[model samples]
Every structure is written in structure tokens, then in C-alpha cells.
Target chain A: MAASMLKVAVGSRAYSSGIRDVLWKLGRLNHVAIAVPEMEKARSFYRDVLGAQVSEPVALAEHGVLTVFVELGNTKLELLEPLGPESPIRGFLQKHRDGGMHHICIEVDHLPDAIQQLRQRQIRTLSPEARIGAHGKPVIFLHPKDCGGVLVELEEA
Target chain B: MAASMLKVAVGSRAYSSGIRDVLWKLGRLNHVAIAVPEMEKARSFYRDVLGAQVSEPVALAEHGVLTVFVELGNTKLELLEPLGPESPIRGFLQKHRDGGMHHICIEVDHLPDAIQQLRQRQIRTLSPEARIGAHGKPVIFLHPKDCGGVLVELEEA
Candidate 1:
């Protein structure tokens, strides 16, 4: 939001390359991620009140979070709860006990080209490489600071 | 993620009604709202880096924010900047100076019936009535606390 107040780095040679030719194709918004301290409570709120169909929770040990997909007609909502002491969700819940929106996932057509474009533009990515996401698709996270304080996940469509 | 870890609330008499017959039909996600401090910089980032076509910033004085739409193939991103000190975006930026995701707008076929259902379920809505939003459509904001800490907007599609 404070992008104008931000110090812009001088345009790099890569960015000077034809911007039209490198335009990446963005796809549908696959899902929005929400971090909750108590997973069941969040799920119940969606299921009982909103009448959304939620999938069974699955633990991704590598990511250190339990995840569930609340299916809606257009897109899905991913609910996350810390699975281990060092889980990042634990840190987030420590600040916001009630939980909060964590990230938004947007699908892209080509993962490799997208990553290459981001790298050339010098955007900060959370992982050096794309990891297999909950959807079993290649996904990479961009740093929140780099993304106007909103963590963004780009999933291969 | 931990849908299984939740304790199910026992059904109340209010829930015994044939509410299932009146299920609200949710449509495609209309847009996701982001609160940014500087509109131009945020626009440039999306336009140049993400290759998104952002619309001209439009001031919504009644809403106390300047809004712009970043057109994606599947969904749109609404960027908001506070218009004055009294603006809610100013308050959100007080806590998160860098700006952040403000809310998500989902479309519903029937907003009045949806609001009635939410009222029946005792869900907290930001306004007692629906207001005309940026798209010139009736929209209502649901309280974040009642929505698992994620501010939600239901727009009549």
C-alpha cells in the first residue's frame, strides 16, 4: 500500500528488456489461505454457518501445518493450523490469537517461466525453488514485504 | 487444516428449521481488496512486474478510499488507499504500515436472502444494510471476527 513511499531500486538491465515480450500469463485464483489457531473452529464456521463442503485435514510435515480445503463453487479456502512447535502458524497466532488471512494463491500457466521472470525482476521469493503444494502442484511463495505486505503464492495451473 | 480437531457444536432449535431449502448460491469471486498507502506505486508493481492491466484510480469519497482494479483473467484485485485521516484504511495502516490484504469479495446470486440467512444465524455484518459498491452493485461487509478474522464482502452478482 505504501509503495510510493517505498524506495524504488533503479531499473535493472533485465527490467529494461522488452516488457511486452516477457508478460506472464496469470490464471484463476485457486484459493485463499487463512491461518487459524484452532482448525476445527474455523472449519465449523465455514461448514455449519456457510454450508461449505470441507475436505479431510491433511498434515504436510514438510510445511509444518495441517491443511484442509473448504470447497466453494468458484474457489477454495485453505485453513491452516500449526502442526509443530516451530510451525510458522504458531508465530502468526502468537500475534493474532483469533487467526487471520495468511496468503492468496493465484494460478499461473508456466511455473518455470514465471519464476524466471520474477528472478529477473529481482522480486523476493520465500523458497529458492517451487515446492509441491497442498494441491500437489508446483507452488512458490513471494515475500510479503515484496508483495505489499500480502504473502502471495503462485501455483502452476 | 485441522477440521478434525474441532469440537462440533450441538445443533440448536434455530438450526432445525428447513434452512437447507434456502441455501444461498455463491458465485465466482468478484475481487480481493487490498489496502495500499500509495496507489501509483502499487499500480506500477502490478502493471510492470506482474504484467497486470490496472484501471485508473477512482475515488470513492463515500467509502473514504481511492480504489483501482487490477484485471486478471479469472479474478480482479482491488487496491485501496485511504482518502483522509478518518478513513478506515488509515486505521489499518496504523497497525500494518506497509498495507495489506483488506478483504475478499465473493459474489452471491441473492444478497437479500443471503443477508437474511446470516441474520438468522446471528452473523455480524459491518452495516445493518447493504450499500452500493464500486461495481454499482449492492454489497454488504461481514465482520472479520464473525468470519474467522477474515473481512468478507458479499456482492450481489
Candidate 2:
């Protein structure tokens, strides 16, 4: 299981640099994922209330969380809820004291190059390698400690 | 001056949808702005430490704040500092009790259409009209109270 996970992770990070290059070319913003304590309540606002198109919530078993994607033009609003006690979303909720903005994800063309650059700079990453994110995009997270407490995600579009 | 500012605001909102649509064509995840009490300290982390290409900090006279933009791939990490006693960042800090994620900006294709759709659904918004944001982007804010206390920013990329 661990080896399979590792393979998936390596494959995801491999596109880091490609993602960076694409972002440079697009010159536009992407999506932002915010952590919410209750997924249903979040959907009420972003989907039902705001009228943003909603995508089915996906369960990320490895992360112990469930995420709902809200489509807005080219970008997306991702609402995350912890599915288990040990999930990081639980700690984020306690620290934030309420639902708040979680992390900023930038769509890149190459995930591996971005990962390599980040590693060269000694930045800490949450994942040992990139993994497939929701919607089949490759993604990796930079640790908040290395990012001044703001979780940064790099995604391959 | 207030009248002029108001006029600019009106004109900006008018073009919001056009810009948003353009951004939508480009891609996902645009930028994430974080508010901090100290600008230089935040700069050290995102710029020198993280190796993100940094832009010179700029002060917005109207908003009474200083902002620094860090370029990472195609997205930006914006760090903000309250410029004066009346700056809103100070209030956000007081209410949140810590320096953390401030707002998540999601790119959209049409601001007016989205806003109208949101209004039709009775979602609360911070402004009835879109406002000129950093980099001359037209943006509107969805009230946190309406989104489970998570302030959501809708922007035209």
C-alpha cells in the first residue's frame, strides 16, 4: 500500500514545474480551498445560496477528509471537512475558531519542476511527493511552517 | 473625492464581468491574499525564505493599506498590512485573534451575472456593487456571515 501510494505521489509531483510554466503563461488566478467544519452548511452558502455550480463531494480516504467543489467560471471554491478524528481539518477548525480560508492552490503546468525548485530552496512540503487530487489533477502541499503558517498548494492543471 | 471614488467604483463594477470571463478562460486558482500585522516579517517568509519571486510592496491610499505580491508559478501570494489606525486589517486581526489566512479569492467569468445569481438566491454580500481591487481587478466580497463565517472574494482575473 505504501509503495503504491509512493508511486502515486511521485507521479503527481513530477508535473510541478510544468504547472508553474502554465501559470506563467495563463496569467490568471485559479481556485481557493477553504476549510469548513460542516460540509452541508458550507454548500448551503456556496452552492444553494451563492448559486455557484456544485460538484459532488469526493471522499479523500488517504487524507481522511471529504471535499466539495464549487465551480465559478475558471476557478473553483473547495470546501473541506474532516472525515475522521485525526484529520488536520479538525485542528484547523480549532485554531481558526470557525470556518475560514484554508489554503491557496495555484494551477501549474509542471508539478515535478515546481517540486524540485521548492526542494532546492529547502521548503517543507506536506507530501513526500505529489498525488492525484480531486478531478484527477496532480497536486502537492507546502507545509505551513515553511510558508509562514499559510498552507500553499501547487496543482497541475 | 468621495463622489469621484464612488464613480470609479461604479465604472469598475460595470466591467467586472468582462474581466472575470477572461480569467475563466485562462484557468483555476488565481491568487490568495493573507493579512499580517507585520509586512516585513511576512515578506521574509514568502520572498527570501520560500524563493517566490517578489514584487515591490505598494500602499493603496484609498484602502489605507500596504500590499506585497509574491509570484509563485501563475498565482500570487499577497501579504497585506494595515497602513493606519483606521485600516480594516487591524479590525480583522482583533476579531480573529491571530495572523492567518484572510480571504480566498475565486476567479469568475461574469461578476454581474454571478452577483445577480447570488442575490436571487438571497446570499449576503459585503457590497452591492463590485469594487476596484489591487492590480485594478474588479472584485466583490461575499459576507462571511452568509458563508459560515468564511469571507469569500469573487474576482475577475
Q: Of the candidates shown, which would achieve the greatest TM-score relative to the real structure? A: 1
lDDT of 1 by residue, B15-121 (tens): 11112444576677788899997887787777767766667678899889998787665677899999966787898988988888899898888999889988877
C-alpha lDDT (0 to 100) for residue B62 of candidate 1: 89
lDDT of each: 0.78, 0.64
Candidate 2's C-alpha runs over 4 A off are A1-30, A107-120, A127-132, A135-138, B1-30, B40-53, B71-75, B93-99, B106-122, B127-132, B135-140, B154-157
Write model 2 residue lDDT over A11-101, tens digit each, in one string. 1132111112221222234567778888877765654444345555678877778987666555566788888878878887897666778
Q: Which prediction has the highest DockQ against the true structure? A: 1
Cα deviation in Å at residue A34, candidate 1? 0.7
The DockQ value obtained for model 2 is 0.16
Q: Pick the candidate with the highest lDDT.
A: 1
- TM-score of every candidate relative to the true structure: 0.84, 0.66
Instruction: Return the number of clashes found in candidate 1.
Output: 7
Model 1 whole-model lDDT (C-alpha atoms)? 0.78
Docking class of 1: acceptable
